[model samples]
Target: MDGPGHGDAALSAPTLTAREAGLVGCRQCTRVCEAADERCPRCGARLSSRDPGALQRVWAWWLAGALLFIPANTYPMLITSTVGRASEATIVGGVIELLHYGSYGVAGIVFFASVMIPVGKFVAIAYLAILVQRGHRTKPKHLLHLFEFVEWIGRWSMIDVFVVAILVALVQFDLIATINPGIAAVCFALSVVFTMLSALSFDSRAIWDRIKTLSND
Candidate 1:
């Protein structure tokens, strides 16, 4: 009784074509339908796109990297001391030293790159991964684009770690100044590296694959 032809005189329903019924959906978005169809069954937009499994792998790596982040921050990342000094300085101590010397900008940048950036990237990547895994359809395209930006920027997280490494390697004076890396530093660096790798491993194009395949099936 609710066939396509049973609509009211003023309101018309979409016509289902054989080709459309057999066409695959895009895995990314549920907005697309076959070209032959007048109305999209999922999204009301004019049929003009494909959905694919574009977010699966990327999100997978993101989650893994996120997990690694917890331990990375919990461990010590750097050690510093004057060659005969009684006290050793860690990452936080280094920042405090810079701040005490009135190097606010340097302190800010160092802390941001070493502490803020990596942690932020992990949290963001995890969120995106979870969203994709849940097959959340209400997301805006900008979110994916935002993910691209985040991944791109995440690589810079190594800047602080590398700088610290260089400092440790270069500033070794018997009774002057010495720098050393801490356990947390290594773990944090590894976490950044893996997170960056995870971001790269992800294939954003697969999201559309899901929509295209499922819709037509």
Candidate 2:
């Protein structure tokens, strides 16, 4: 009733080839086949997992982007001018202005889509990366839940980009309420994109696999 040993022969072990080795435990969910489902008993990938370094790289980008995002949100992202006089607005300031002007919908949307979501994504992704780097079994299940949340919120963090795009494209009426996106917008946009890429590139199975191997060793 016991399983085959690690290198034991005559047991017909499910060995993976070179290329397929990296994709060892990744199998269909059998219910809904998506980009996920790293474990599959039917596919014999249950023991095979992912690359541990992948999680470390993901965290590097995430933590760095989070650092950049702090300033991006704090600094002025838009400068508006009329009669050669200008007013600057950080993200929070812009939100408040919108609310003051009775643009509650715009303000609410900006606050959630841009401010809250980006910050939340950074924090969540960083935490997951840290957990994986620990490389120990009995891992926090909530980290997986947080990872799911990070994936779900990743795309929505591009609201700042959309806002900038719209402003640069539509607000071309010079001599009126002109809008020029500042340095902060570019940095913020890049932070969101890079963090998103980092999260997607990460492989959680790799972390767990390394942990399992080390623990076995």
Steric clash pairs (candidate 2): 25-45, 50-205, 50-206, 51-206
Best prediction by lDDT: 2
- The Cα error of candidate 1 at residue 43, in Å, is 36
| Estimated TM-score for each candidate | 0.62, 0.69
Q: Please write out the lDDT profile of model 2 over residues 1-217, one tens digit for every residue.
A: 3555666555563554322443333434422222244555455454323454676678778877888888888788888886678889888888898999999998998899877888778767766666566565656455566777787787886786678778877776787767888888888888888888888867745544545666777
| Model 1, runs deviating above 4 Å | 1-64, 207-217
- The residue-by-residue lDDT of candidate 1 on 51-127, one tens digit each, is 33435555566667666667666655666677566455555667788999999999998788767877777777666
Model 1 lDDT at residue 172: 86
> RMSD, each candidate, Å?
11.2, 9.1
Which number leads on TM-score?
2
The CA lDDT of each predicted structure is: 0.65, 0.70
Give candidate 1's TM-score. Answer: 0.62
